[model samples]
Each structure stands twice: as C-alpha cells, then as structure tokens.
Target: MSAIRPAAVVVLAAGEGTRMKSATPKVLHEICGRSLVGHVLAAAGELEPENLVVVVGHAREQVTAHLAEAAPGVRTAVQAEQNGTGHAVRMALEELGGVVEGTVVVVCGDTPLLTGETLARLAAAHGGDGNAVTVLTAEVPDATGYGRIVRDDATGAVTGIVEHKDATDAQRAIREINSGVFAFDGRLLADALGKVRTDNSQGEEYLTDVLGILREAGHRVGACVAADHREIAGINNRVQLAEARRILNDRLLTAAMLAGVTVVDPATTFVDVTVSFEQDAVVHPGTQLLGDTHLAEGAEVGPNSRLKDTRVGAGARVDNTVADGADIGPRASVGPYAYLRPGARLGVKSKVGTFVEIKNTSVGEGTKVPHLSYVGDATIGEYTNIGAASVFVNYDGEHKHHTTVGSHCKTGADNMFVAPVTVGDGAYTAAGSVITRDVPSGSLAVARGQQRNIEGWVARKRPGSAAAKAAEAASRESDGEG
Candidate 1:
C-alpha cells in the first residue's frame, strides 16, 4: 500500500461581497459566534493541512487581521484586481515558495457550513482515483446562477462546466451545479490555472474553466456529488447571510437536543458553541446561553434569561434571570427577575428572588434573599431571610464596606444595613429600621423612633371644618323641631 500525499488548503476570500449591503466585509460576518472565514479556516485546520493560504483583496486589512486572530500561522495573499476565483487561487499558489506536491483543496470562505469531513472526502477521491482535478458538485432545485456540469454520457467523465448565462437550453436544464470547491493535483492544477481564459461573458477568469483545460490536455477530471447541498451553499447577500446563521443555529440546537438536553423552543433559544448542557437540562424560550456556560443535570433555565460564563449546579432553576461570571450551587433558585453580576455566588438551595441584584456577594446555603433587594459586597450566613426591599448599604460616599449577617438571622422589610455593620446570629431587626452598628447575638434590633398620637384638638384648631358645619346644622334642625 502507498501512502497518501499531503495536502494544502487554499481559501478564496478576495472578493468584496457587495450584495450583502453592509459596511462590514462579507467573510467577516459572524455565524454561531464565529466569522464565516473563521469557520472555513476551522474546517481546514481539522484536516491538518500542510500549508493553509487565504487570498484577501477587498478589505484586506480587516480580513488579514481576522485570519491572524482566528488561525495564526496561516499564509495570506492579496489579489489586487476584482478577478475571478482562478486568479485568486493562482495568487495564493504564487505566495508558496516551492511547487506543491500532493493536492490543493480550494474552498470558498463564504461557505460557513462547509465541514472538514467533506473536504477530506474530496481529497481522498482525488488521490484514490489518481485524477488531476475533482470537482465537488451538487444537484440543486434551481441552478439559475450556478455553473452546470457537463459529463460524458458513456463514461460519466466530467467533460466541462458551463455557466448558467452561457449554457445552451439543454445544458441549462441539467440539475447538477458546480460548487466552486475542488481538489486538484498540485502540479497539474498549477499548469491548468495558466491556461484558463477570460473569454466568457463576464470576462473574468473562472476557476471552473480549469477542469475543462485539464480534461482537454488528456488529464482525467472527476466529479464528486456532495451528500448535502446545504454544506456548499454560499452567502452573497443579506438574505443568504441570515439563512446561513439560521442553518448554523439549527445545527447547534440539533446537536444539543440530541445530547439529552430538552430545548423547549429551539426557534427562540440561542446557545453558543462553547455552551454545554448535561442530561435532563431543560432550556426554555427566549434564553441565550453564551460563553463558557455549563448547565448541570436537572437544571431548568428560564422563560427569559441570559447566562454567560456561569456554572449552574444540578437541579437548580433560573427563571427570568440574567447572570455572568457567577457560580450557583445545587438546588439554587434564582429570579423571576434577578440580575446577578460578576463574582456572585449562591450556595445550595439559596434563593435570589424577584427584582433583586447581587454583585460580588456570596449567600450561604438555605438563605433566602427574596424580592426587591440590592446585596453587594456582602456575605449572608445560612438559613437567613433577607426581607423584601432590604439593602446592604455598602457604599458610604468615601469607601465601600462589608455587611455580614450571621446564621439564622431574620431581617425586617425595608431595613437598611449601613455597612461596617454586622447582624449577629439569631438576631432580628424591626421593619423600616436602619442599623448603623453591630447588633449582639440573639438580640432584637430596632432603630426607628417611637410613635405618639394626639387627639381632640381638631375642633378648636379647625372651626371651619366640614364636620363642624354638619354638627351645627344638625343642632339647629333639632332645636326647630322642639
């Protein structure tokens, strides 16, 4: 058995996709948290290509910068003119120092859904058949703007490719269209690129012309029908860009669903590629789980929530909550409308309830910081009840201080714990109180002034009152009856 030769990948991203109607470069458009060009580079990286080159022309600076970040060490070439695919690939070939020996897999950067499996298969077919050029073709429902494949009826050898605008009536009716992706023998491809002519209607050098040139020169040319045509779909305009995003999201959602996660509404949910969900994890509508997020088993995530860089423990429920960089323990329940900021940690079975915001704080197990509170730069012990509308007044205009509430404490509604303050274990605070100093353990803390009531002074003070007028009228009416 002979060893399969090495391969290099050439990504064509030189053209400015003006049809996309956006200021941003087309290939830089994002899908599933990655740019279209980045996805293509990722696919090529999977095959471990010996040399990877990207041809950039329009918005070269932007494209080059993106490729540098996304795929470091990959080569780049510039196509000065608005030439066709053949010219772009040729420019990429020129950037290489020596002749490429094995194969050159040409890919379009606008195709985000193109996978490494298909590229490997294309390269394999080219090597196994000992062919000079192998074109990836698909049968589309409408071949209107695509190039149609022309094959010999007897041998099924690809004879040539005819563009839709230039094809005859019979050729235009053919269903199989060229995908603009190919695997070519390195030397034969280089030789054929030189012979491709700019004599077509567009007067641009079409890469499809290379196949016919190789065939006429007595080198074999073959075609491989792609398993899924959607993988080869290209993004040209805004509509197609949106379609690509939809397809990529669908792919991610499908994978997540198949991995034992229950997505209540796939249409409304947006899960990033880096997010992971364990079995029995349930995701509700309008939820977006982004960067570095992980949901443990039996975790229920909301009717409307956004979580990023957060680890949710098993059997936890987050409803209508928004959190980032937070760690939530098992059986924790958060929000009908809560916002948890970075460094927020909730212990097991703890509750961060409606209209609450917790930042850089930690709540102990079984504690309930339920509705309408702001807890920041503080720590609460287990089994404590943080009354509704209570606040940890950590900021005092000069500096921020800490509030510590010991275990088994019960705070009153609307209480303000002015910081540098501590509420001892088993302590209780009166409603509407503001505590500025520490309270002793097992004590009842009350800071409000005592209330007093004054009565029977209204008649003299307000003789013109409606009550006085009504009483006087009643007395006159009784006297007249007597």
Candidate 2:
C-alpha cells in the first residue's frame, strides 16, 4: 500500500446556528474563551495539514475576523448561502483551484473536542488499509438525531449512511453513527463531491450521498469506530454549547490536577484551553481563568474571581475579583471585590483592597490601595498608602491626565487628587482635602473649606415673639377656665 499522502483539512462552518439565538456567528461563539472553530483549527494544526481551509457563512465577516485574530495564516473560503455539508466543502474547494492529490480530511467546525490523536489515527487507518474513503464512526446510545452507518456484515465495510429522518425502525436501532468526519483520497473526494445531488428530503446536497456513490463505483469505503462517542458531538444550540464547555473544562482540569495543580472544586472552576498553572497553584471554586492566563507555583486564586489574559506570580493571592490583562507579582494580594482593568500591574507584596479599581496604572512594591478608591492612569511608588475614599480624578470630561505619588506617601480618607498633580516622597494629604497642586517632599497639604460656628443665630431670629406668644396664650387659657 502507498504511504498516506499529506492531508489538507477542510472545516465546515457555514451553519446558521438558529437555535443559538444570538447575533454572534455560531462558529465564533466561544467554548472556554475560544471560538469553536479555533479549537478545531488547533487540533487540525497537529496533523500538520499541507493547507487548512475553513468554509465560513452565516456571519462570514465576524467568523473570519475571529479566525484571523485567533489563528493567523489560516486560509478562508466564503459559503455565500446556507447549504449542506457537501456544498460547503465544494465551496471551499474553489480556493484550492486546480486538482491536487493527497488526503482531504473534512470535519465539522462545531466539534471542538475532536483531538489531534483521533485524527492521526483515522488518517493512518485510511492510508494503511488503502481505502478510498474512511469515515469516523461512534456507537452512541442515543443516535436519534445522527446519521446511522450501515455496514456489510461480512466485510464490515460501510455500505451506506442513512439519515435519522429517512431511516426505518430497524435502521434507527443501529448504534453506530457517522461522525461527519472523513479522510478521503484527495482525487477521489474531488470526484465524488461532484457526483453528490440535492435530491434528499431537505432539498440540499448531502455529503452522506457520496458514500453510496463510492460503494457502487467499486471503491473500498472503510469506517473507523472512535473509542469515545463524545468526540463526535457537535454544537448547534446553547444547551449543546454548555455541554461542550463542561467536557472541555473537565479535560483541562483533569490534566492540570494530574500535573500537580490543585483544583479545589473542578465543577465550579472553569479554566480555558490555553490556561496554564504550575505545581501547587491552588484554584478555589467559582473561579474562571480564561484566555491564556497563567498561575505560577504557590499562587492562589479565588472563591469567586474571573481572570483573563493575565499572569499571577508565585505566592500571589487573588480573591473575589475581576481582572483582565493585568499582572500580579509575587506575594501580592488583591481584592475581595476589586476590579483590575487592562494594563493594571501590582508589584510584589502590593495590596489592593475591596471596592478599589485600578485601570492603566501600576503600584510599586508594597504599595497599598485600601478600600473605596479609583486609581486610574497613575503611578504609585513603593510603600505608599492610598486611604479609603481617595481618588485620582483622572478625567476632565475631554481628556485624561496622570497622578504621581512618590515613595512613602500617605493620603487621608476622602482625599481627592485632581489629575496633573504630584505628591512627593513622604508627603501627606489631610482628610477631606481636594489637592490641585504639587506637594514637595515631606510637606503636608491640607485643602478644604474653613469651619464656622453659628450657635445663637437661631435664638435671635425668633427673639421677642417667643415671650409675647407665651403670655397671650396664658391669658386666653385663664379666660376660658373662668
């Protein structure tokens, strides 16, 4: 038998996903912070395809945009209309232009959990057996909605694929179902795809029809049964999307736990596919780590926190916070209710308190922002203390400015530093102050309204009227008593 030729991957992603009920493109809907197509593309990359072609429709622009951002160098073809799987592949073939000879693996974009190993195994079986077509099959208990694979009892070769809608009672009883993934001789696939017709009940060109054509043409069509049926599941609705998410999460969490990461409650802790954690990194329940997040050894993550595209250094602790595009250094402590926006960085041993928000700012080592503060577009030196209710008023409606606080500085509660101000090292701001200018090193700045007393002012305003009214009331009461 000839060796398996290098294969090109064609991912079908043209389904409208009407059941999903959202404006977002179906393939672009995320599973663990990654688009469904993104996951499939990563798996296909493992096979080292000579070329990768993704058939996009529905929201073509949105799907292409996401693919461009998530996986560069991937080629795309537009399926202008919602069509059957066979038609989708034919649309993608236009991008290949002339005829080429190799294996062509066609897979569904929504089956994100299809692993690289399974594809490799399928390709090997196809080439080793010299089959003209190889179909990946799984024996699912509930195959009600899937296409049942009809095999010849003697040869165990796939004779046909009967769609559930058209299958008889006995055919529906068969447990083996077609996964819609196929590895075919490139030339054979190109030839067979042209022969497919849209005479089915749905009035769409069916890919399964190609199996019968291959069979009648004296070509050997083979089927490889997958060990796990879940590998073949596809996402078309929100319920299935959630199921895929749970499965993916379980796979990642299991791998991490085996690698020495501590996941306290895997059920409630959601980790993305690209997230990594070192040994002894403990993740608490209700924590969601997404989008290339990393936690170093000894780091601890929350009982209710969400982190994305961020890094947490060793020994850092994050709890009940929402952080994105931020870095927490070693030994730093952040939030039971803090918000760390993009570009926020906390140095080693730094502390961010409850209700504090940090945006586009950096806090030096040991610096503290303790409760009820907004530190945006600012830089704080080491060991500085930002008191409760202190704010770096960074915006003036039209523009944003920066505030600088030097080392060892302290700001009292309710202090407001209007932007374009600086507090030198060791400076102090009194409580209830609104600082508008720079304060030199070691100086104290107190800006507030002066206090005044008005004790007897109320008594003088109602002076003689009080005694006259009292005597008049006494005389009236005496006359009434007589």
Candidate 3:
C-alpha cells in the first residue's frame, strides 16, 4: 500500500460513446464480471480518497444504478448534458461540496487497464514535485486524435496541452499525447476550472485548457509519462473493448500462474476476477471458471468445463462438466458430460459419472451415482451405489418431493425411486424396479410385475412377419432334435 492518499477522485463517464452503438452505456459494458466504470472505480478506490465522485451523463440512470451496486457509498454527480471533460469535472467538484483540499486525481472511466499503482505514483509525483498540476502523458506512435503535450525547451517542464483539432503543424508532430488523466492541487484546480472557456473549434470547454490557465498563473505545470501506453488506452467501440478485455484477462491469468496456479492453456481458459485458485490447482483447456468459483489445492478441472459460483475441493477432478452453484468434496470425481445444478453436492470420494444430472441433491461419502442418472431433491448415504439409468422421480405435476437411500444400500440398474420414498440401510432394489414405498433395512425390494410368456402369439397375430418366420424355423429345428 502506498502512503499517498488523494483528497478526491473525479471519474469522467459522461461521454456518449456513439461509436459503440450499444443500447447499454459504454461505461456499463462489462469485462471479466465487472463493468468498465466499475474497474476504474476499484482502482480509484484504492487511493482511499476522502471524496470519490463519478460524473454520469449518457445513460445516467443505468450507470447510477450500476454504481449503487458496484461501489456502494461512492457518490455520483449527474451531468444533465453531454458537455466536455471540463464540465464533467466541474460537476464532480460541485457534488463534492464545491471545495476540496490536497491532491485531486481526475481519470477517465473507460480506461479499465489503469491500475491503482499508477494512480498512487501520479499522486506522489504531484505532491513530491510541488507542482500545481501534473498531467499523465504517453508517447504513442500515432497521436492523430489526442491532445499533444507541449514542453518548454529550456527546462523540459510542461507548458500547456494543445488539442489535435486546435494544434499547429509543429504541435501535431509531437508524439507525446495527453492521456486526459491528471493529478492537481485541489485549490488550484478548483480556481483554474472557473477560467476555462469554450473558445475551441469544438465549442466545448476542454479540460486541457486548465493546464494552460494554471501555467500562466506562475504555477509549475509538469507531466509524468506513463510506463506503458496501454495502461492509459481508452475504450470507445467494440473493437477496443475486445482488445482491452484480452489485455486484462492476460494480466489476470499471468498473475494466477505466478501465484502457483497451473493454467494448462491460458489462451483457451477464461477466469473471472472474483474467481480464486489455491496453490497447485490445475485448470485444463477450454474451461471457464466464473463468478466466485474456487479451486482448492490439487484440484483438477476439465478439458471443457464451465463452473460458476462453484467450489471444487482438494484432489477433486471434474472433466467436461458444467456446474453452477455446486460443491465437490475432496477426492470426488465428476463428469465426462455431467451437469451439476444449483444446490448439488458430492461428499468425499463420491462419484458422479457420464451423462448424470444432479440438482438439489447430495451424494454422501464413498457413494456413486454413475452413468445416465438424473438425481434431484434427494440424498444418498455413505457407501451406497446408484446404478446406471436410475432416476429419482422428484416432480409430481404439482410439487417436487424428496427421496432418500440409506447407508450401504445397493440400488440396481434401470431403477426409478419415486419421490417421497426411502430405502433403509443395507437394503437392495431389484433391476427394473419402480420403488414407491419404504423398504426395511437389510431387505430386497422387487417392485416390478411378474414375468409372463404367450406362446405362438407373434405367429398367430402376424403369420408372415420376420418374428413369425424366425419362430417357425426354431419350431422345425426343435422338432427335428426331438
């Protein structure tokens, strides 16, 4: 944690991103489970500012509603009109009670790649150099549309900023462009913003004008070049959004890898910011770990799995599965095409095999629900075996009911346990049985109808059919043997 704390942070999110062509506000567009503005607020919040206010204009209600949830307790200033950056900051200062002291940081909300460390460094640079205003500058290869940072030849101090539309030929050649991010002396900024005029070609009050106003007032104006240009990159349209998303995801995956999590194929794996992995956790290709999911140490998940808000315990293995709001215990095995829905849980050493669907159910320690089973609203005790093609019939047209299989039970293949039924400990169910009533401990329940045969039925019903012909041939062979 850096010791530098800003007096306030004004985030400008008032621009109407027409290029994005989205019904949703540009700042509200999400990347890795967080809105673009939310990412900015998180970085700005790290500065521990005394006052943090966001200026919202385009899609104000939606952005404000999102802010309420994303950063509760952080204030917002509404810019009723889509004006320039100068007006946005003025609105934020007004919402901050019209007076602020100490260093104030101003940033754009669409730059989700900006980090807390960079903001802290900027604030520290402003305070340490005793400058009235310090603009964040980047040297980009193409500076066609950005404001050019003008520096004095004698002392290399920032003299002013010239917007691209208003720059001279020589100024346009300058590669050092303004990032539109700044750290300023609070009192100086509040006074300088008052003198800013809408005299530019765009007929809007450019925030860059404040730099010249402060410079002419005999206050020192400086510039801090960002270490990386991408950190200050802004998102305007879908293309830039995708680029930023890729960069941020790469950063997250790299950090996770450095922290002892093994991402087998980082290019194909996607992880949310809220997801966490313990040391030694391994994630396979084509896996998406999303929304507060956690992987314990030694857990291995999928070549093609997507888990949301789920927990996989140590030593558990999940392959080719989709699980949401589920829990798998240590040493448990799930999937080769399983679906674990909300409230599904597998105890230690339990197994859920291919084509199994578990919902609102629990499999106890050492139990197995293997292949082609749909188990819902049920619980199976320790050491029990739920055979292939089994169904826990939970829905009854009006309500969903529960089923229970006690410890050490052996359930046979093709079994249907109707809801509101139970099988006691050590009990067994015969194959092809439909169990409806409770079975006593150590007993065998055979609920299917008795077998019966009707001889020559196929021959009488269809004399020339394939079944009848085969029956006639078998009868001739039997007669010859007799």
Query: Per-residue lDDT for 314-344 in model 2, tens only?
Result: 9999999999999999999999999999999
The reply for model 1, stretches above 4 Å from the true place, is: 1-6, 393-408, 417-430, 434-482
How do all the candidates rank in terms of TM-score, highest first? 3, 2, 1
lDDT of 1: 0.90
lDDT scores for all predictions? 0.90, 0.90, 0.92
- Per-candidate TM equals 0.86, 0.91, 0.95
Supply candidate 3's per-residue lDDT for 430: 96
lDDT of 1 by residue, 66-114 (tens): 8888788999989999788989988988998545778888999999999
User: In candidate 2, how many Å is residue 53 off?
Assistant: 0.7
| Residues 84-158, model 3: lDDT tens digits | 899888898899878688888999999999999888888888888999999999999899888999999999999
Clashes of each: 0, 0, 0
**In terms of TM-score, how similar is model 2 to the real structure?**
0.91
